[model samples]
Target: MTVLILGLLLFLGAHSVRIVADGWRSRTLARLGEGGWKGAYSVVSLVGFALIIWGFGLARQQPVLVWSPPTAMRHLNALFTLLAFILVAAAYVPRNQIKARLHHPMVLGVKLWAFGHLLATGTLADMVLFGAFLLWAVLDFRAARLRDRAQGTVYPPGTASGTVAAVVVGAVAWAVFALWLHAAWIGVAPLGRTF
Candidate 1:
């Protein structure tokens, strides 16, 4: 649990810099060139990610139940996760309406993913992991939107082809993850597959 908490702090702390200390972040970026800043950020993020994986694994070894979620919640999480994947794809795909409208689909995806997982899983570690992410995503999304508004940022209008492409990519990725990777990597099959 301590390791999990530490990991969450490090990960979320790194992510929260822009939200909480944009001025500082900007100054740092200026002091260090874009390349240097990115290099440092990537290193911190990676270390945090490693800690999160290790901590979550350790916490899961001694399962501390919080509240038992109904089976329906798990099914609902599948739908939410599917949408999350679509949003994730939107964030990447050029000129997708989802991204154009949302302006921060990736953050929204994180929010949805965290919320869905929180609903589906009821354990101390699960709450710590998903809850923290959910909170961070909400704040980050809000901060990003505010920044966009302040800067008069405009997303390109989306074409039908781009939208279709995003949907396909998201659906295919979701299917693959749900069918195989979730079970293999997360140690729990979201789709409840026996294999």
Candidate 2:
């Protein structure tokens, strides 16, 4: 629990910098140059991510029940996760309608992903991890949108081809993760067995 809390703090704190202190982040980027700033950011993000993985694994070993979610919620979670994957794909596949509408598709994806996980799991560790991410995503998404508005940023129009590509890629990625990676890495099969 201690380790998990520490890891969450470090990870979330690093991520929250842009949302909380945009001016400071900009100043540091200017002072350090893009490459230097990227290097530092990568290092911190990696360390924090590693810690989060370790802590989450440890915390899961001693599961603390919070609330038992309904079986129907599992299906809902799957649907939400599917949507999330599409949104995430939109973030990379340029000129998609999803991305055009939601300037920050990645943040929206994070919000959906976190919400889906929260619905599926009901343990202290689950709540802590997913809830924190959900909260952060909401705040970060709002902040990012606000910044974009202030700058009068306009996202490019979407193309039908790009939208189709995004959907296909997102579906494939979601299938791969759900069928193989989730069970292999996380020790829990989201689709195979109901919890």
Candidate 3:
């Protein structure tokens, strides 16, 4: 749990610089040069991610149930995950309708993904991990929107083709994750719930 918390702090804190201390991050980037800054960022992020995975695995060894979620919530989680994947894809696919409307599809996707995990899992470690991400996504999304407003940012009109592509890619990715990757990587089969 300590390791998990530390990992979250390092990972989320690194990610929050733009939202909480854009000026400081900008100065650091300028001082270090873009390549140097990115190299450092990547190393930190990787270390933090490794800690998160290791801590999560350790925490799971001694399961601490928080609350048992309703079986129906798992289905809802599946739906939410699908939507989250679509939003994630929208973030990368240019001129997608989702991106045009949301302006921060990736953050929105994180919110949904965290929310879905929160609903599906009921453990202390799960809560800490997913809840922190959910909280961060909410705050960051609001902050990003505020910054966009301050800068008079406007999303361009979206094309149907781009939206279609995003949907297709998202669906395929979601299928892959839901079908095998989740169980293979996380050791839990989302669809094979026995509870």
Candidate 4:
């Protein structure tokens, strides 16, 4: 639990720099050069993520049951996860309407993903991990939108083809993950519940 908390702090803290201390982050970027800053950021994020995986794994070893979720939550979680994957794909697919409207599809996707997991699983480790991510995503999305407003950022208009492509890509990715990757990597199968 300590390790999990530490990992969350480090990982989320690194992610929050733009939200909490944009000025400081900008200054450091200027001082360190973009490459140096990226290198350091990557290192920290990787270490933090590794710790999160390790700690979460350890915590799962000793299960702590919270409120048992209804069976329907698994199906709902699948739907939420599908949306999350689509939103995530929108974040990368150029000129997608989803990104044009949302402006922060990745963050929204993270929020949905965390939320889905939280709804489906009821355990101390699940709550700690998913709850922290859900909270962080909410805050991060808010901060990012604020920043965008302040900067007068304008996303380009999206084409129908691009939008379709994003959805297709997202669906394929989601299917792949939900079908086997989740079971292989996370030891759980959200889609299997419905299938």
TM-score of each: 0.98, 0.96, 0.97, 0.97
Residue 107 accuracy (lDDT) in model 1: 95
Query: How do all the candidates rank in terms of TM-score, highest first?
Result: 1, 4, 3, 2
Candidate 1 vs candidate 3: the lDDT winner is 1
In angstroms, give how far residue 161 of model 1 lies from its true place.
0.5
Where in model 3 is the C-alpha error above 4 Å?
193-195
How high is the lDDT of residue 7 in model 4?
92
Pick the TM-score winner.
1
lDDT by residue (114-190, candidate 2, tens digit) is: 99999989999999999989999999999999999899999999999999999999999988888888888898888
Candidate 4 per-residue lDDT, tens place, 76-104, comes to: 99999999999999999999899999989
Global lDDT of model 4: 0.92
Model 4 regions lying over 4 Å from their true place? 193-195
What are the lDDT figures for the candidates, one per model? 0.93, 0.89, 0.92, 0.92
Model 2: which ten-residue window has the lowest total lDDT?
A: 186-195
- Report RMSD for candidate 3: 2.0
Error of 4 at 8 (Å): 1.1
* Clash counts for all predictions: 0, 0, 0, 0
